[model samples]
Each structure stands twice: as structure tokens, then as C-alpha cells.
Target: MKKRVWRSGLMANQGFNFQKEHPGIALCGLDCYACPRYHTIGSSRCPGCAGKYFSEKHPSCGFISCAFKHGRLESCGLCPEIDTCNRITRLKTVIKDQPGYPSYQNRIANLIKIKGTGFEAFADTCIHKEALLKTLIDKYNDGRKKAFYCRAVQLLPLPDLENLLDENAKKGYKSVDDAALAVSNSLKELANKLGIEVC
Candidate 1:
């Protein structure tokens, strides 16, 4: 498989690394590239699960310590015991119980996709997702809506997000605040129509 490594967009030193591991895709299947923490400007940012200084920038995670760090694999889905992994099963159970955290819900399916397509191909999709998120962070972010934009980009389909952005681009805004509000409303409307939980 071809390694579709990409340079970081808005976050060159922030995250989106391509050193030896894929910073976009996590071992547990979180889209780290689309995470709010990855886009944080003021606070100390999360450099992604596999990003540079990952062990230093972020807290010590059980998932990494237990499985990921011991091997060279980019994801737990590559493990032979993925189907019988107790930690992953429990993690999925926790995710299922958390209705407020919609992003976590995508992890299991993402892991399965990694298993089928391999890390490189699955990460190709993640790079595209990150690109969409990067566009929002770079243009639409009004210093406060980073998290909201991240959630919207993560939950919504790529085509839907692309179309929404294209539609919004044709409109005029008075200021950064106006631009933010306009996109916010549009994103909410899209979320409602799609029955997507973006909080």
C-alpha cells in the first residue's frame, strides 16, 4: 500500500505528524486530526495520539501503554487479537453509554475500517477529513468556535461539509464574528437535517 503522508496544514508544529506513525489515526480509532484539542490555539494542544512528543505533550494513556507502545503497528486493528481484545470491548461499551460524546461512537467502526483497508488507505481518508477541518480552522474559526467546528467536521459527511462550505463561501459577512455565526447556523441546520449529533 502507498503511504499517503501529508504535511500539516494549519498545525505544522501543532500535530498532523508523519514521522514514523500516523498522527491522524489513533490506535483506538479516534480521528485525532479532527479533534478540537489538535486545533487548540491558546491552551497546550494535543499533538495527536501518534504525533511528535506524543508521550510528552499528552497524558499517559492506558491504550498506548497497554498495547500500542509495545509494537510498531499504527493501530490496534492491526493486532491479531483485535476481535478478542477485552480493553477494546470495554472501551466500546463505555462509548455506547455516552450519548453526549458522539465522536467516540465513530471509533469502533473506524477501527474495523482500518482492519479492512490497512492503515495507509484508512489514513488517506483521515487526511482528507483533516483537510476539511483545517479549512474551517483557518478561515471560519473566530477564536472561539474551534471545538464546535471540529465536531461538525467530524460528524458530518465529507461531501456534505464540502457542499456546505461552498454554499457558505458565496455569502458575505460583516466580520469574523458574522462569518462564524453564519457557518454555525448553517452547520446546525445541516446537522438537524442529517440527524447527526455534533455536540
Candidate 2:
């Protein structure tokens, strides 16, 4: 069997067209454009984080595992405790007043309200989403909150995790456990950069 490698921008639907268009060549901090799995079908739509995109592929997103998914809501904003999740807390820290901050917050809140649960629920729903979940948890515990809510953050934004792995992979780690510890620390460093709460 040949090994299958997937990037963030590979897509099957070449005929798909992007309904949501960004007029100006504005760079959203996210690198969805670089993803090999984005709608390569020519649709301007982003399937990675878009709920609609997920619905197309039945059993598509980690959101289904989210508490909110079963709750019959779209996002966290509808939750009575929308302000309480660590994810939301971290987002507020770095995105304050940024052009897209408010919109991001609203999106998460809406997802929770509509989906009715924490992103962890969705993340745990699939193995593919597991790495992203761990990254988010690590970021939250470390103090960096910028990765909150946005699926893109959950996916490729693992600077801290990567650093630790890069260091450990080269260093003579005493054991696999030691390497794990290093990765944990990297996540902490990332959190510190974002001022996320370590609780």
C-alpha cells in the first residue's frame, strides 16, 4: 500500500465555487490559502472550519463531538457561560481591538450557541482533530490564547509544540516521556506569549 500524504489544500470538488469572497488581498493571520486540502475544487469556500462545508460530507466535522453539536446550537455564543471557556479567555487576550477579533469572538460564540458545546467535544470527535485539541489545551495551559476558537489555529498553529519536538527530536531525550515533557513546556511558552491563563 502506498502512503497517502495530505496537505491543507487538497480538495475533490474542483467545480465548487467560493461564495464568500474577500475582495481585497487581505491576509488573515490564518494560512488557509496555503492549505493543500482547502476547496481545491475551485470553490472559494473553506471546508476546514466552515460548518456548511462539513455538512456536505456527512459526519464531517469535530463539531459533532462538541457538546454544542448535540445541544442543537451553532456556536458557543449562545451558551450562558460563553465568557467562561478558557478558549474564549485566550482569544480576548491577543485579539483585543484587532480588525477581526470581534468577529472571531462572535463566530465562536455562535458556534457554541448553535452547536451547544466546547470545541473539545468537536475535537475529540475525530482522530484528525485530536492534534488540534491537544494543541489548544496546551496553549490554554501555557498562557497563549491567540489560538482560541478559530479552527485554523487549532490546526497549524503549534509553534510551541513544534519547538519542543524540534528540540527533543535532536536532543538525547532520556525517554519518550521526556520528549513529551519538552512538548508540554513548549506549549507553556506559547501560552506565555499570548498571556493565556495557566489555570
TM-score per prediction, in order, is: 0.80, 0.27
For each candidate, the alpha-carbon lDDT, in order, equals: 0.76, 0.39
**RMSD list, candidates in order:** 9.1, 17.1
lDDT of 2 by residue, 1-199 (tens): 1233332222322212221122110011122322323423466544543334544644333322332332533333444554566655655574555554333333343344334554344333323333444443443323333234233333333554455545645667565455445555555566677765332
- Per-residue CA lDDT of model 1 for 1-199, tens digit only, reads 1333333232333322223367667788888887888777654887777677776676556566545334656788888888998989998898878765555878899889888988788787678878878887887878888888888887888888889988888888888888888898899999999998676
By TM-score, the best candidate is 1
Model 1 weakest lDDT span, ten residues long: 8-17
lDDT of 1 at 9: 30
Question: How high is the lDDT of residue 69 in model 1?
Answer: 38
Number of colliding residue pairs in each model: 0, 44
Among all windows of 10 consecutive residues in model 2, the one with the lowest summed lDDT is 19-28
